[model samples]
Target: MQRKKLSHQVRVSTEDSELFRQSVTGARPLMQDKIAPVSKPGKKKARQAVNLSQNEQQLFFFSDGYEGFVSNSASLSYVQPGDDPHLAGRLKRAEFQPQVVLDLHGLTQQQAKTELAGLLAYCQQQQFNCACVIHGKGLGILARKVPNWLIQHPNVRAFHTAPKSWGKHGALLLLLKINQPELALR
Candidate 1:
């Protein structure tokens, strides 16, 4: 009896569905067909990669003359103008884990600059919001240059000196822009 009832319900549902489909068959689709085009999620990421790779020079240029002087304090912190003012503080508290890391341990200044540019571009391309930059608070040249360069980049949202477990004063936890157009540099 239960099987009969189930079959009956299925038959009724199939008949109703067929009727509904027939009723809609005579109705014309919208003339404009105003649906916007949307790329697949994977394609979107690939497109970003292509855009960054193709137009990288114009996208990420860090100038030493961007600022005459940036303080070299052990506690480094920065936040882009329109971003959350407390972002650096939140980063220091380890609210977001760094998904990628770029270590400048023994690289020359020129090498470091190249690596920095590539890392920043790659982060944007890959849609990574958080990354760690281990500048190794050395004789202060790399540390100082690193922060200055970072501040100049339009995409760096916020950054703070890494906490004890991450790298302490020797590294910085960076909040990078992900899947968003960069804010104009100040």
Candidate 2:
């Protein structure tokens, strides 16, 4: 059976319209208290007073300093002059236990650089000689850039690939030089 549908229309009366208008017009805005503006977090003050070039500052702020392919293999060892020969061997053999471990697996380039800088600074302040960084073997971004960053750090003496048990090519063992002035006071 076919049924006819009826449409209903809503209409506002003049009194209701007048009342709504009056209500709207009579309502006052809520009072708002003034709030002090919050200051954004500023860049951390450098531990040392040395001035950095504009390029260097930009490097720290923007990139991890890895421009392109690194020449060395991840397994290759490194030892700076005046450093113990056994240090490289020890790092390769996983001899010196790492007091701190920083993992940069999922971090972006900038984040990894910032964290690496902070960790190295903390390690230096605490007089820690050895630390481990797990950069992973993703697109080789961190693996390549982390080494470059470590090289730029003043306290970093040498760094080498971790052994098989300690993450192999994906991690590095860092040897940090103690701050001479701080050491002299001890």
Candidate 3:
């Protein structure tokens, strides 16, 4: 026995087609103004777009010791050995107020390192328990570098990404080691 192939065609009514067209037209914007044409290319601007000033360039030139580190992930975190196990959780909860805040936005790597070192020194001298560093989530350079720098700093006991209200992944909450005097008092 031989089997025969069957074919079928579907059609829409003229009214249905007209209604669909009208719906699309009605949903479109009524304004028909043409966009202004882009100006013809003129003499090419300088290829090197250096936005940094002399001082900023100097700072960038001084960046050293950050050669081998790469950004691991957006949700990076760290806690020193023997530090409070709950430190990361509390940071996530925003339980502690930042005694000092450093915004490292728009700074080159060296500039940021210098500022961070100064901030840590200041916090250590003042015996601050916590500080917040807002390192924006730009190209992740700072994000990666900050963690590595913090790991090397003697004062940082723990650090983690800030909570939602505290700049989230773009910021870090650092728990500084208590001063010897303060520890003795306790």
Number of the top candidate by lDDT? 1
lDDT of 2 by residue, 5-108 (tens): 76976799999999989889967888878898999999987754222343244346334444532545547566776777777887777778889998888999
Ranking by TM-score: 1, 2, 3
lDDT of 3 by residue, 1-186 (tens): 996665765689999999999888848567968898999878877633223343343234333674533446666577777888888778777788899999999999877887777677667667898999999999988887888788766667888888877789899999888776634655
User: How close is every model to the real structure, measured as TM-score?
Assistant: 0.63, 0.59, 0.59
Give the RMSD in angstroms, all C-alphas superposed, for model 1.
Answer: 16.1
**Which residue window of length 10 is worst by lDDT in model 1?**
43-52
Q: Could you say which candidate leads in TM-score?
A: 1
TM-score for model 3? 0.59
lDDT of 3 at 63: 37
Candidates ranked by lDDT? 1, 3, 2
lDDT of 2: 0.74
Candidate 1 lDDT by residue in tens digits, 63-139: 76666335556598889889999998999999999989989999998778877887887787788989999988668
The collision pairs in model 2 are: none
